[model samples]
Target: MIVRPRPNWFRMLLVVRGSVLPAILPQLLITLAFALLVTLLHGRVFVWKVSLTFVPFSLIGLTLAIFLGFRNNTSYARYWEARVLWGEVLNDTRSLARQALTLVDGPAPSRIFVHQLIAFVHALRHQLRGTDPAADLDTWLSDEARQRLQGARYKPSAILLMAGEWLRERRRQGELAAPLVQAMEVHMGHLSDALGGCERIAGTPIPFTYAVIIHRTVYLYCLLLPFGLVDSIGSMTPLIVTFIAYTFFALEALSSEIEEPFGTEPNDLPLDAMCEGIQATLLELLGERDLPAAPKPVNYVLS
Candidate 1:
């Protein structure tokens, strides 16, 4: 997220701030310490004597390493894909809002529909964050809309359906003709797909058992890596082990963090900011005052 690279190492280090060590830092510390101790005592004091021929442990560890690499790679792909899909959703939501305001015929319900569209954005942010929208939805929602959402199991979807029903009613009253109404339906469908896509990503996560397996394998690999290298590497085992552990651990940590890129985390997708952008665009069409302002991230971090 650090754009415009600073030449100074100190500045760059500060830029990377809390991206440093994770909760698994303790494991890294243990791995490095064990590696140094074994390497120092490798030939001088003892040998683990684990090998593919004499001991089967070495081959097992090697196989685990290959599995670790592949697991991390696949998880990273999922993480990246989730972000990309959300980005598309963000764009499409803006487009839907624009169409809803401009194309829909106006007055009471249509004007209310424009506001509800904005409320839906925040509702979606709440849905993604797994929180109630009661705190923030007041600005965009009317009393009737809020009352409808009171016990709704899925608030965002409910709000969306309201928009659809409103559209149908308008068409019924001859407020919108077939072509314009059909065009509005298409945009509404796009919003529906976007909502469904995000819901799918949230509802169906990577299998828990596979995650547990990958975590256990990474731990086992680090544990055995020291023993394998210590006999040959000597005192320098600490540095080598740390470097290797850092690379693997970093990848694992990154994949996990980004897998659900819709939170308060530094790299979380800019859903709130994106929603505000949609609000602004739609408000321009409604010519509404008290418009929502974009939430600019502090130090390039948007939550």
Candidate 2:
């Protein structure tokens, strides 16, 4: 994700790091070249003159823009929902950490609970991004705990189960009150809800056929635009078509990037930074001053 101050308008026009320009550059170039060719040939295919008026394009463009706007809104909703789920995870984990520290009796058990909570956060992040959790798990989990998670399909759930058992054991030992344990359990359930929400978003996506139709329509419209404009606009057809194509192409590219918000793309949620922030905040609650360094944006992009 982009994590920089907004640039001036002039600079914004040339900004590339977090924009969709790179993804749609090839399509834009193709549109530009095709428009130029059509203009030069006077919208002709050999001896056949391809005559088209701007009327159909005007109507189609209006409808196409509406569809694109709808799709973009749907994609942004997914992106925003994913971010909200992560925010819930952060808040719930912090609450759990506080409960373990203040309510639990022993330092040793509380430390174990806090470490497991940290592990759970990193595990969920890795799970969402489809990355290995071995390194992150090893950092906060015991050898026995790591072994238990070795072949576990869902590492975050495994860590949550471990945390639950930790709480149960503490309760059995008369270390934690029944009421406080129930309170912590509520936070744990919130964590589970967040995990499930993230999973649903990651597993289900906008229908491929829907995306395909919009993608095909955008490209076809851009390619056919020159034929419609060449007769009327004459020499300006290439510039006009290419400018219009850029908008459609860029929007499609951006929507595709954000639809899967858990990805490592520049526009995707900064899961790494988010997980680290959760770890830091929880560790700080445990009286640790020296924490892991926060992730910094590289070249104005965070991942």
TM-score of each: 0.83, 0.98
- State how far residue 182 of model 1 sits from its true place (Å): 1.6
List candidate 1 segments past 4 Å from native. 1-15, 18-23, 43-70, 107-109, 288-293
> How many clashes show up in model 1?
0
Model 2, 1-303: lDDT tens per residue? Answer: 998999999999998887889888888898899999999999999999998999999999999999999999999999999999999999999999988988888677898899999899898888888899899888999999998998899989989999999999999999999999999999999999999999999999999999999999998999999999999989999999989999999888889999999999999999989988998998899899999789999999998
- For candidate 2, give the lDDT: 0.93
Tens-digit per-residue lDDT, 80-174, candidate 1: 66666656655665666566656666656667787777788788888988988887678878788788888898888898888888878878988
Clashing pairs in 1: none
Per candidate, the number of residue pairs that clash is 0, 0
True-structure lDDT of candidate 1: 0.70
Q: At residue 25, give the lDDT of candidate 1.
A: 79
Best by lDDT: 2
Worst 10 residues of 2 by lDDT: 100-109
